[model samples]
Target: MIRLLSIFVLCSFSLNAKSISSNDLRSLYSKGQAHWPAIQTSDGRRVEPMSLLPVASPKPEHVALGDKLFHDVQLSRNNTVSCATCHERDKGFHDGRTTAIGIDDQVGTRNTPAIFGIDQWQSFFWDGRASTAEQQALMPIANPIEMDLDPKIALARVNKDKSYHAFNKSAFNSSTLTTEQMAKALVAFERTLAAPSSRYKTFLTQLNKNPQHAINSLSDSELNGLHLFRTKAKCMTCHNGPLLSDNQFHGTGLHYYGRRFEDKGRYDATQNPEHIGQFRTPSLLGLMQTFPWMHNGLFDDLAGIVALYNHGGVRPRPRKSQLNDPHFPKTTDLLIKLNLTKQEQADLVAFLRIL
Candidate 1:
C-alpha cells in the first residue's frame, strides 16, 4: 500500500509539470505569430523597403580627411557655414526649424530632413530628384540658399589646402581634388549615420521569440493606439513596413503661405499631372524629435495632422492645388464624423511617440 501511494504521488507531479511546460510553449508560439502593425496613407499606399547599396568603408585617411572637410567653412563661398551648421548631431542631424537656414541666414523652402538612414533611401530631397546619396550630397554645398559655394571653386579651394593635399595623396594615391571626390567623401560619412535600435525594433525581436512577450512589452494604451492606427485611422496605408514610409507622394491639401507659391511638388520634377501637389513620404522613425511636420512644414502638432486626416483632407478647388483623392470624403460636414474622443487622440499620439 505504501509503495502504491508513492507511485500515485509521483505520477500526479509529472502530469502537472508536463501541463505547465505545454502552457509555456503555447504562449511563446502565440507571441511569435502576432503581426507587427503597419501604416497606410489616404492614397491607399504601403511603405516599401529601402534599397541600399553596399558601401565599402573609407580608408582611415579618407574618413579622417572627410571629417575635417565636413566641418570646414572654407568650402563655402563666404566661409560662414558648414554641413555641421544644419546637421548638428544633438538634433538627430537636423536643424530644428520649419525650414533650413543656411549661409547668411538664408531661409530655404523645404525642411531639412534627418540624415539618418540616408543611404537606405533610393532618392534624396523632398522632390525625390536626386537618385543617389552621392549625387544628393553635393546639392546643398552648391545651392545658393545653403552653403552658397560653387563646386568647381570649392574644389579649387580644397586643392590649395596643404593638409587636404597630403590626405588626398595618402587616401587616393593622388594629389588631385575634384568635385566628384568631395561628394564621395560626404556621402560616405552620411551613410554611417544609421539609427537601428529602437523600442519598435526590440518589440520585433521579442515578438519573434514569443508574441505574447511582444504584446506584453507594449503598454496598454500603445497597443490600443496600434489597433486604431492599423484599422480605423487607416494610417497603415502609407506609413507601412519597417521604415513607415511608402516613398510616394500625396496632396494632403495643406495651406501654403507664399502669395504665389508655385511649387508643383513632384509634378515639377516628373511633369505628371497625377503627381501635382504630391511629395515623397518621410520615415516616422524618431518622429517625436523631428517636428513641424510635412513637406511644407505646415502642421505644427500631430493632433492637427490626425484631425486633418480624420476629416479626409481639405477640399479641391480649380485654383487650389490638391493631391488627395477627389472621390474621398473631404473634411467637410457632409462626411461621417470619426467622433474620436480627446483621450483617443492622446493615445494615438502616445503610440506615435513610441515609434
Candidate 2:
C-alpha cells in the first residue's frame, strides 16, 4: 500500500511539473522576477538577470604600472613565476592546470581562479579569506607554496626597477613607493580585464527589444540548454545574476573530509563546523575558457560535471570512523537529482560552452 501511494505521488508530481519556456524566462528576467520552480538560497537571494556594468576606467598610468607588475617575475622569490604565469589571457586568465604549480614546482591544493570580472567581486579566493583586492593581491606573493617572496622584498625590487619609476610615480603621485600603492595598481589593471560580450548577452538584448530575434542569436540546441539550465538542471539556484554566481558558499560534497583528499575548504578560514566543505560559488562568465573546474580541479570535462550534478552531486557515504564526526559535511539540499535526459545533458553542455 505504501509503495503504491509513493508511485501515485511521483506520477502526480510528473504531471504537475512544467518546463519553463525561453520567452517566459526572458520576460521574468526583464522585470527582475524570480522564474518559477526556483527557490531562495539560505540567504534569501534568488536568480536574477546578469547586469554587468561598463568596464571600470582607472587611470592609464595605474593600468600600465599594474600590467608591468602583473608580468614581472622579479616579484617572485626565485624570479621565475609572475601573476600572468597562472592567469594566461589566452586561457581565459586561468592556468589550465589541475592544481596550481607554484615556485620551485610546488603544487598547491586549490585550482587557480580566473582574474576576469574580479573587480565586481566582494570576496576573493576559494575560501573567501581576503575581503578586498588589495589584500588578495599581496597574499600569493608571500604564500610559501606560491611565489615565496616577502612583500618587503617585492617592494624593494619594484622600487629599484628603473622602467617602473615613471609608472610608480604616476600611479601614486609620489616619488616614494609603498606596497598599498602597488596593490592598487595591480587591482586597477585586473579590473580592466572584464569578460567580453557574449552570445548570451546578445540574446538577452534581443529579448528586451523583441523576443523574435533571440532565435537568430542562439541555436536550437543552445536555447534548449538555456531552458534546462533554468528549469530542470537547477543551475540558476546558485549560478545566477549578472556574474552567474550568487557570490555565496555552498557545499557540493567534494571536500573529502577525514580522507587523504580532505580539503576543509571555507572551514579553514572560519573554523566553523557549518562551513566544513563549502567553497565560494565561482562565476560562469568564462566557464569554458577555464578548465579543470572545482575547488580541487578534480573534473576537466563539462560532461562529467553535468553527470555529477545530474545525480545530485557527490554524496559520499561516511565511513564507520567518520560516522561519529559531527562536522561531516552534507551536500546542500538544493542539489536534488535532475533526471536530465542524455540529449538534455548535451544541450546543457552546449549552452555552457557558449558562456
Candidate 3:
C-alpha cells in the first residue's frame, strides 16, 4: 500500500492491442493473482517499470519542502490544523476518527482517506471535486471548516517564507516560490508514498513461476476467500487493478433518515441525479491499517465491511423531504443479496487483511 514512483515509462503499448480484453491478462486475476497492470501496457507489450517517475523534476528538495509543509500548522489560519491533522502519517495517513474534525472542532461528513495510494487516484475527494493532486492539495487549506487558511493569505505565507527560498533556489534555480510550486512540492512528496510489500504481493510474485509455493503461503481459509472474492463476491468488478480500485465512482446505497444531515456525494459536485449516493471506489491496499471504513466510516472493521456487502448494504431509510425513501436502488450492480455464510464472510475479511 504506496509510491515515490519516479520512474516513468513512455511507451506506445496503450495505442495497440487492448490490454483489457486479453485472456492471458484476465487469467492473471481470475486465478487469484494480484493486479499489477504495470507489468504490461494496455496493448499487451513488454514495458520496463519506470523506477523513477519524475514528478516535477524529482528533486530531493521538493520532497523536503513538501514534508515540512505537510506537517506545518502555520499553513492554517489558526495554526491548529494541517493536512496531517486529518491524514496523520502514523495512522497510515488517516486520522483514527469516524469523521474528520477540523479547526475549531468543526466536524466533516466523510472519513479521512488513507493517502498511501492516493496519488494514483484519477480524482480527489469522495465527491471527485478536484481532478489533479495539485488542485486537491490546496483545497482543504482554504476550506472554512478545514485548515481555514484563505488562498490569498496562504499564497502570501509561502511567498514570504525566507527559509523556503534555499530549497526553492535549488529546485527552481531561483530563490522564489509560488503556491502552485508548493502544491507541486506536496505532490512530489506524496508520490513517494508507495505500497509496502505484503504477503499477498509476495505470493503473487511467485504464482506464475511456482503456483504451489504461492498456494502454500496462504491458509485454506484465505484461499477459499480469494476464490469467493473473484467470483461469488464479485469484488474485482470495481476493486480491480494494482491499486485494487477502479478509480471510478459508484453508489453504496447507505442512507439514514435518522441522521441530521445528508451527504449527496458525487451528486453534490456534478448536480447529476444519476450520481446520487455515489462516491469514489477506494483502494483495498493496506486495508488492515485503516479501521472504521467507508466514506462515512460507518463500520468499525473488515468484518463490518464484508457483512455490509453480504447483505447488499443498507436498506432504503425512510424519507427526509418526502414521505418515503427514494425507490431507486442505485448502488453498484455487484451489490446484491450475496447469501454468504458467516465463515465465508469471515474468510473474505481475512483475505482483505492479507492484501
Candidate 4:
C-alpha cells in the first residue's frame, strides 16, 4: 500500500520538461514533501531527503575505539598527525587549506574533502578512487605526503596500546587488531560526522503542515534563487538528489593539463584517457561551511565560485605543442553559459547558503 502511494505521488509530480515556478515548487513540496521526497527535476530524478548517517548505530564500544584510533597521532610515521588534523570537527571536516598540508608540511595535490555522508557515497575521494569508506580510512595513513605510516605499522601501534585492548575485544571480539579492523573502526567514527541538520530541513517539515507558512520561511530572493537553480542555473544536472550530488565525475576545465598545476583527476585512477580532468561531483550538504571550494580548493569566495559557473566553468586552452594531442582534456558540455543576471547569481548563492 505504501509502495503504491509512492508511485502515485511520483507520477503526480513528473510534469516533464515544464517550467517549475516558485509556486509550483512550493505546491509540489507541500503535497509530497512528507520525507522531503518527490521534488522531481525536469529529468524525473527525485530530490532525495537529506538525513544523518551513522557512525551512529555501531556499538558504542566500536565507535569509541574508532574515535580513539582516528585521533591517535601514532598512526603517522612521525607520530605528529592524525585524521582530525585535516578533518576537524569544527571546520566542517575540512582543514581550510587550498590543498591539504600533510606530514612535515608536505602539500597534497587535492583539497581535503569533507568526510560527511561517506556511508552514503558511491565512491570516495575527489577522483572516486576508493570504493568504500573502510578502504578510504587506510589511505591517508600510508600516503607518504599525508601520514607516511604503513597500515601494518599503524595497526601495530594500535595493538601495542594497552588501553585499546578492551575496545578491540568489545568492538571486534579480538585480542589483537588487524589492518582491516582498524580501518573499519575509523570509518565507524567518521560516519558520525554526517551532514549537519539545517533550516531547509525544518522548512520541509513545516511545509507538510502549512504550505504558505513553509513558503514564508525563505526570503523572496532565496525562493527566486531556488527557482533559478532548478531552471536557468542548471545545477541539477550534476548536483541533485538527497545528497545534492550526482555521485559521478565531470571535467570542469580546471585540469590545467601540461601546466604546473595539471591534475588528471580520475584518469590517475582509471588510466582511461577519457577520464582525464574529471573529478567527482561533491555534495553541497555543508555548502556554507566547506570553503575555499573545488577539488583543488582554488576558489575562496562563494560569489566568485558562482561567477565561474555562471560563465559556464573554466575552459583552459591547449598549448601549441599539445594541439594535436589526443588526450587533451575538454570540459564537459554539462556546464553551459548560464547567462544568469547579477541578481540571479546573488539569489543562487542565497539558495546555496540554505543547503
* Per-residue lDDT of candidate 2, residues 15-38 (tens digit): 112354556544444442233344
For candidate 1, the TM-score is 0.76
Cα lDDT of model 3 by residue, 205-312, tens digit: 777666656767767667656655655565665666666776778776653324554677887789887887788887666666666667777666566566666666
Model 4: per-residue Cα lDDT at residue 153: 86
How accurate locally is residue 89 in candidate 2, as Cα lDDT from 0 to 100? 85
Task: Tell me the lDDT of candidate 2.
Answer: 0.74
Candidate 4 lDDT by residue in tens digits, 129-215 = 899899889999999999998899888888988988899999989987888888888888886776755666666567666767877
Model 3: runs farther than 4 Å from truth?
1-57, 205-211, 317-329
- lDDT against the true structure, per candidate, is 0.60, 0.74, 0.66, 0.74
lDDT of 3 at 252: 68
Clash pairs detected, candidate 4 = 48-242
